[model samples]
Target: MTESKAPGAQSSYEARKPQTRGRTRENTPLRHNFWVDLKELIAIPDVASRLKPPPKTNKRLGLRKTAWCVFHQVVGHNIRNCLALGFQLDELVRGNFLKDYLQEPQGALTTAAPTEDQGHEVPIHGEINTIAGGFSGGCTVSQRKKYAKGVMIVETQGLDLTLEPDLVFTKTNLRDVVSHDNDPVVISMVTTGRKVHHILMDQGSSTDVMFWLTFNKLQLSLDQVRPYVGCLYDFAGYQVEVRGNIQLCTTFTSDAASRTANIKYLVINAPSAYNILLDRPALNRIRAVASSRHMKMKLPSLEGIVIPMKSNQKDSKRCYENSLKTKRGVCSVTIQPPGED
Candidate 1:
């Protein structure tokens, strides 16, 4: 391969270099390594047909040599060093086409790394307090560990709002003038589409009661009464007789806001200060709170707004005075209508 040249001058490439005959495979930059030379692999009829030939070029770069690529069927390079051929073979290997022929060890990472797409879920960096209290009320371990730990073992998205935000009471809710604590929450409510006054909302009582006198005054049919199998308990002063209970549409209104529910009233034959006695059950049903000091009953309406019903102060004092008179046998129990308690 030695050729004579002028002093300090480079010789012609063809004269200085050994003749390759275009047969030598260029070192493949592609990373695909196979158990055998790709030239030998594509010998199979199926592989040969699938193999894509590199672009045909009639013009040779004046290299007077001959070496044929089986894949390209051209005189340039071997299939092993062909960039296009190597890439296609790597794709076939990844598709499990030449599994046994691959240089990558069995069960090794041969495929390209997976890319994140629309299906991949991103980590949501947020938490919600579905359970307010934890193991301890004071949150002994601080807020999270404090209260109701026995219940909050597993975190979860819980109940679909069976309750609204808790309503609170304030000093402004108190009566403008100091009223005696003896004042009762006696407000008017609509029942059977008629305004019924002297309805006492009492928390101490265990049942919602409508005296037989008011029951008759409403002109309700006896057929509407369903047989109540429960035991009857009498209030102080009279032996109460239990009439079958009836469900009535009773509405508590505070100006524009109102709440109405079919209340199952235990129609009782007894004399009391009020026409309708709403006890704990009724108060709870309407989600109401009665304060004698405030002289008003506040309840959440259907829309979750607080509605305030001011107690009839004049009627409340009258009932209190009459209650004293009744204890002294001054007021008769026969006319136990409104303002008699």
Candidate 2:
């Protein structure tokens, strides 16, 4: 029987034996060393970080150099506009590696230093309760940390504003006693070569608005207006229709200094006492501070000098009276139609 073994049968059995042996591989232990595992865990995040393309410069596009985020020393975008870095910062706060930046901007020094355990440096100049807050309260850490590392600060030729302590409102500021009320800080600002009066500086508003009639009076035509689809709410609790939008180089000046800003104004056809209103957007742009009690607004000029604008109390009162008269006239008008009694 042994000699009778089929010659081809042995070859077939050998082939089947290899397949049967392959199943035993399941019992073999996975080759994992402590060093290898540790190395792999450490290399995981680096692998992901490398997936992003490197930042580069193109001369043909006439583009500025790409901003480098100082927080992580990445070469692509600056800290001001980096969302990933912002998220990391927030995560650090959540992890208790850094203090929450929800406090007011006091005398706390906002300086960063290197730490032993942290992968990157963090602001360690002040305690959690004494940390200096940012200018805006919109996003807790977004705007405040924009220039946190002091790497995005740039020098521009025109109207480069620098906050000065002297700009703070004081009791000595000249204000009209006759126009004392909760009325907005109405001042005169030069826009498009016209000394626009009755311009209300409203911090509560989120936009800079220019009445349609005032836009026309500025010698600007409807064709110059860009198409804008937006709604505005008025004091009468009605949604005012927006006609269009126009960008004008608005200038605010004092005797010693002057600052100009390219203000984007939403043109709306609405009747109000103010010819134009400068709101939070414009205020933040110019770094201007308003003091309703002082009846004035102040900002840093191009030369870093404090520029102050005093409210036009007399014109304010006059405009208020005119608005009241207009309101009364509209109320007195009666419409009659032919009807069967």
Candidate 3:
């Protein structure tokens, strides 16, 4: 505060050194390697104090108890908290509600009451009466309740239950009765070398003949077959091709006499729907009769009908024409005498 001097006034008596230009190597500061040493120091435990425990409060609870309380409260707790506590609300509600729901009244769902027929069972001691008109020899009868469907039950004695059809039967063995009027028949075919049970027959088919399945089963090659186009009708009214030709050996015998007949058959592309058809041509060839009443065919000379190993084209043509006529919906077929044609 004593008489202030001006801002730039200074003394000139101090020593003056020469001014240096740019940076110089001699004036640089030194750096220490203490960082590596500091890391080593931190590795040692503190020599003074021990670790302390965390704070505790009455409001804090175990995870399971917290979840249980939160679930029971249902107000402040949310699904996330319930999941964290491992609590399932839906399962708990279902278990408790199911017991209560089942204990309620019986007609809660309004379901219909079951009728007697709905739970009907066949009686052990039920009486069986044969129906009046039946194709077979025997049928069983069971009385139907008023409200039940008009179903009659037929029973046959001494017959195996397992062999019977599921439907009620008015008669058993109707082939005998049906043959009296319609002349029932059965026709079967077997290739030359194969076994004899390969008979194929279909009542619904218009023609009875051999099929490729039997041909293949017989181990006969296609080259051995002669191609022939012939007509046949199936159950569905579709026309099928009689592909190749075959010859069967049949033996026919009657009480009076016995003879062998060589029968030729046309091959047809028969699907599994109809494997082999015993048409009128095959029936007329063997002079066979089918009885619808007894479900059997009678061949008086069945043993004498002989099918040869080789077939002739002329004989095959005659068989095909007969089968065609049979397939055309003709009711009956009778072979004309050999000299007539």
lDDT to native, each model: 0.60, 0.54, 0.35
* Candidate with the larger lDDT of 1 and 2: 1
| TM-score versus the correct structure, for each prediction | 0.47, 0.47, 0.30
Worst-scoring 10-residue span by lDDT in model 1:
332-341
Error of 3 at 255 (Å): 13
List clashing residue pairs in candidate 1.
134-147, 134-148, 134-149, 135-147, 135-149, 136-146, 136-147, 139-146, 273-341
- Deviation of model 2 at 341, angstroms: 54
Write down the RMSD of all candidates, one decimal each.
30.3, 22.2, 37.1
For residues 1-341, what per-residue lDDT tens digits would candidate 1 score against the true structure? 33333333422222112133232333222345677776777776555555555455553311213545565565444444444565566555544566677777645543333222111112223446322211113212332333346466775878444544355667887746356767887899998978999987766554577889899999899999876543343333343466868889889998758889878787767666678878766787787888777788888887877888888888887776666654332111111111211
What does candidate 1 score on TM? 0.47
Model 3: per-residue lDDT, tens digit, 32-148?
112223223222233001111112223322223223222223222332332212112122222232223233332342212322221111112334742121111111122212212
Q: How many residue pairs clash in model 3?
A: 55
The C-alpha stretches of model 2 lying farther than 4 A from their native spots are 1-166, 174-179, 235-237, 325-341
TM-score of candidate 3 versus the correct structure, residues matched by position: 0.30
